[model samples]
Target: MSYYNGKRVLITGAGSGIGALMARELASRGAEVIVTARRIEAARKVSREIRKQGGRAIPMLLDVSDLDSIPAFRDRLHDKAGPVDILINNAGVVFGGEFEKVGLAEHLNTLQINTMGLVAMSHAFMDDLLQATRGHLVNICSASAFVALPYGSTYAASKWAVLGFSESLRLEMKERGVDNVAVTTVCPSYIDTGMFEGVRNPLFTPMLSPQKVVRSILRATKHGEALVQEPMIVRSLDLLKGALPRPVWDEVSLRTGVASSMKSWKGKH
Candidate 1:
């Protein structure tokens, strides 16, 4: 049997891209999937497709950025699906541009959805997760979290916060005797998802597919792995950043085009 068989998995931002893909992947693995997105119709479409494929799934409206929506979302979940055994914080937005070029609202909204929303959802679901005999929290961070990304500054910062928060929460959960729950943080290089549509992949670092990322996530969750850095190149770059001096690393990044990969970004506007 698949490790995910019979597990109840809740994925945020399942309307499209990585979130929707994760929902489909988990359902295919025999998990009962709850697909939530800000848009009700979008969520419903994904849920319906999963059901048509003989997988268990339900759609729900969950706007993580709205604090007022969470309590009601929680109540609805409790009334419908009980506690989820796995929570995938996969909903995020990316706005790629130089710091000064982007509006302040864009930066703040990035934090609100990518950082604050993740935090709020985790807090709202923590108790239900604790109630499970075994629970997993999967956070979708990015390779950008590992280093400074010039053009994608705000998005990178939000991911950095997520990486830090995921690690800290993992340790806290362990120390609190919540051994049954595991936290996994995933940091993958540029994914081919439309979110980064025109962004260039740095030299030797290709864009990953959503399927590849979802597979890595499931493997990590099943084995209780703490961190997942995909494509090997991402890991190598992270190591290089740690070993090299700051200026040297920056120069290397510049030469490799890592520092300016987003120069051509035409992300979801």
Candidate 2:
């Protein structure tokens, strides 16, 4: 849509997986993208690839876990390009292990990147976004946000926080007369990214492709949708999980071996 044309989009975790896919898709559609990754070299490579395709892209070194880097990132961003029109909080980490077996440091790091990072980045750019009025903030959440699996307790907790934060922010923005600034949250099933590579889905549910997920996000942003859910089947399952009794659902989860797969996946990797 014309709304996306020439939009300045800022995305985190843009080195690979869904983050990189979204960057390429947005650039191809006429958006100037600013991509940040923990690894500076990976960011540069992605930037180069995008440029070679005749798209506008700039790479920056960013580690969401490192709070000290935010101010510098903000300054460099403002110096290079003006305020970003769209912010995609897509950087995240997953530590797979039995809840009791997982170390406190790993759990804390997961929360730091997935939850705290989103909050800090949004606050750092809130003023600019509000001034623009016509802006969008997209948070990439997971199906874990709705239901917590055995090994994903930490990941699920972080995403649940994100889901709540995004919705509440949307409401606050509305009261400020910044109706044009849309906040959309996306929840998808396991992706084929290396982070979750060896994880098996006992149900044989086809893992959603990052590209398709990106397209759905763009579509939602264009249409002003508040929430974007991929693979209608996944959405249905979410509803089912909520409607069923907790014990029953827990049994289904245990019997399906969903938790075991995620926990065992760590060793396989």
Candidate 3:
């Protein structure tokens, strides 16, 4: 028996990639998955497959970037999925390029969808988590949150923001003595999700498979872990960055291929 069994999990951007994979994985574990995406068809496709496989699933349309409509999205949830027991803020976008080459609008859109949208979802569904017998919040961040991603600045910034917010929320729950709901922030390296199509892998950090990352997420969420920083290198980020002086860290980043990893990035626009 898994902790996800019977849990009503809501996953954003579950049209494809890691989001869709997570939806399927959770549903197979006996979870009642709510697969949401901006494109209704995408959501329906995933839902249909889950149902075909004898898993519980509900497909819904959700544009997390449209902060105003999030309330309405939550309201609609009451009619179909009901109050969610697990909220996975997996929707995100990327405009990978040199700092100045990426348009201002693209950079801002990255933050809007990746950071603001995530915050809005967390706010809108928070009450449901509070009321659930066992609730969980999962935020799919990135290894860039801890290190530098030169060509993907906004993407990194958004993940960094998510990391901070997730940590704060987790601590706040602890302070409030709210043990029913737990927060888990997942930070994985460059995933082979086609999002980073042209990016070079950092030394010793091979591109991760979506399935592997999703499995780790489920395990961490089930165990109520605070964070999931993967690839072993990620686990040592804080120590490496914090212990080294500014100039020394800069040199280390460059020498380790982390700084140049995104120099040639051609991600999904």
Candidate 4:
């Protein structure tokens, strides 16, 4: 039987992009997918598509940034969706530009959606995960979590925070002997999603297609992997950055175009 068969999966930001793709794929694998997005129509559209493909999916409205609404949302899920075995925190937003040049609200919104939202969803659904026979928490972090991203400062900052929070939670779960639950953090280079429409590809790191990233995420999730960072170049990022002296690493980042990769970002999608 497929590992995903009979699983109950909930994916945030399933209106489009990789989130929607993952939802459809998982449903096709025999999981009952709860597709969520801030826009009700968007979520329903994905759910409709999944059902048309003979997959099981239901649409729900969610805005992770609005913490106050989470409890109520959880209550609604308890009543209808029951326990979610896999929770994929895929909802995120990015605003890229010079730090001070971008409005403070834009920067704050990025953190609210990308960081706070993930934290809030995890906290709300963790218990449901624990009660399940085998549970998984998939957080859609970013490669920026392992390195600096100039001109896209807050986006990097938000992902860096996710990396820290997710690792901490994973360790905490282990410390508490909660072996039934698995926490996986995904860190991928710039995806071809419109959210990063104009980001320059860093040397040796070509832009990734949404399909490629989604496939990797699902493959890793099935095995309860702790981390899923892609592109051959990204796998060694932390090691290279940590092994090299500060000055040398900075120089490497500059030479590799990492330092200025986002200088041309013209996206808010």
Candidate 5:
């Protein structure tokens, strides 16, 4: 199915990393893509590349962390393209610091961009998406949402909030018979993105490729899958947590060196 063909899709954090890749991929597939980031130059560069590749896309300045900026963001999008058919909340952050070492401001910053920003953007576009009668809200979460490892308490908390928020939104949408408007949550382990440039993962699970993630997300959304976990193994881990007691799993995880490996990576990074 040419699911993305002619679809109006808006992607945040589209200046670089997975967001940039996703913008290119979707646009290549015929989607009318609108990408946003804090830096206008980066967004314009990516948009230019997409257009050069025979795709439809435009660059816009957006700082998801700033709620006040959303109206202007929406206005720009509205002027360029009416209501978006797909809203991809792919912007996020990860700060590697001890729970206590990470100050309140930094922690709040994490929440602002990784959590609240997503919520605000989605909410801002809700009226448009609803008017379209058929649209998708895809929230990019992380495997960290499942478990909090060393030095990632804050990051994990933000992601966990995303997971919870997505689930609740799903329920609310279903009850309202908003069948045409869907919500999808993507939870993947460490992606080979610069965000985790100095970070490490001990799970030994293969990191996800940006292109591969985009493929999965597109396929799953087209197939009507409510959630897409990039690596199937992550799903198994989720199940394992439920099967085993929390304390037992925690002890095993720590003894298995996953925690240590994470710390070691932090030290090196």
Candidate 6:
């Protein structure tokens, strides 16, 4: 039997891209997936596709950035799907440009969706997760969390916050002796999800496929791994960042094109 055979999984931003892919993947593994997006039609489309493929899925509307909507959404999900065993915080937004070129509201919205939304969803479902015999919290962060990203400052900052929050929450759960609930933070380099549409991939750090990332996330969740950094090169750079001086790391980032990857970014966000 599939490891996810009886699991109840909830994924935000399931309308498209990574979130949608994760929902489909988990459902194929026998999970009962709650596919949610800010747009109900989009979520329904994904859920319908899963059902067509003989997987179980339910569509729901969820705007993670709207704090007031969270409780009602959570309640509805509980009433329909029972307690969630896996919560995937995958909803996020990114606007890439020079700090001055990006509007203030856009930057703030990036934080709202990427950071605050993740926090709100986690807070709302944490109790249910704790009650589950086996629960997992998966946060889709980015490699930018490990370093400064020029031209993508606000987006990077939001991911950095997510990484910190995930790590801290993991440690807190451990300290509190809550071993049943595990936290997994996925930090991958650029994904080919059109979200980073015109961004250049750094040398040796090619854009990752959503399938690869989803597989890694499931593997991490099963093994109770604390972190998942993909493409090997990302892990190397993260290690180098901690050991090198700020100026040295900055030079490396620039030389490797990491600092300027977003120069031509015309993403969908």
Query: What C-alpha lDDT do the candidate models reach, one value each?
Result: 0.90, 0.84, 0.92, 0.93, 0.83, 0.93
Model 1: pairs clashing at backbone N, Cα or C within 3 Å:
none
**Ranking under lDDT, best-scoring first?**
4, 6, 3, 1, 2, 5
Per-candidate Cα RMSD to the true structure, in Å, reads 1.1, 1.9, 0.9, 0.9, 2.0, 0.9
Structural similarity to truth (TM-score) of each candidate: 0.97, 0.93, 0.98, 0.98, 0.94, 0.98
In model 2, the Cα lDDT at residue 259 comes to 57
Question: How do the residues 1-269 of candidate 3 rate in per-residue lDDT, one tens digit apiece?
Answer: 98788889999999999999999999999999999999999999999999999999999999999999999989988986589999999998898878898899999999999999999999999999999998899998888899888888899999999999999999999999999999999999989999888888878899999888998999999999999987888999999889999899999889889988888877775
Which residue pairs show backbone clashes in model 3?
A: none
lDDT of 5 by residue, 1-269 (tens): 47789899999999988899889989988998998888999999999999999999889999999998898879877887788999999988777766787688877899999999999998999887788757889999987788766777778889999999988998898999888888889998777775765555555567678788888888877775778886877787778888999899888678755555445334213
Error of 2 at 263 (Å): 2.6
- Candidate 1 ranges with C-alpha deviation above 4 Å: none
Error of 3 at 137 (Å): 0.7
User: What is the TM-score (0 to 1) of candidate 5?
Assistant: 0.94
Candidate achieving higher lDDT, 1 or 5: 1
Candidate 2 or 3, higher lDDT?
A: 3
Tens-digit lDDT string for candidate 1 (81-153)? 8888999998899888878889999999999999999998889888878888889999989988997888889
- Window of ten residues with lowest summed lDDT in model 2: 260-269
Writing each residue's lDDT as its tens digit, candidate 4 over 60-131 gives: 999999998998999998899798999999999888888998999999999999999999999999999999
lDDT of 5 at 203: 57
In model 5, state the lDDT of residue 165: 96
Which digits, one per residue and each the tens of the lDDT, describe model 6 over residues 1-269?
A: 98899999999999999899999999999999999999999999999999999999999999999987998889998898798999999998899998998999999999999999999999999998999999999999999998788999999999999999999999999999998999999999998899999998887888889889889989998888999998898788767988999999889889999989999899974
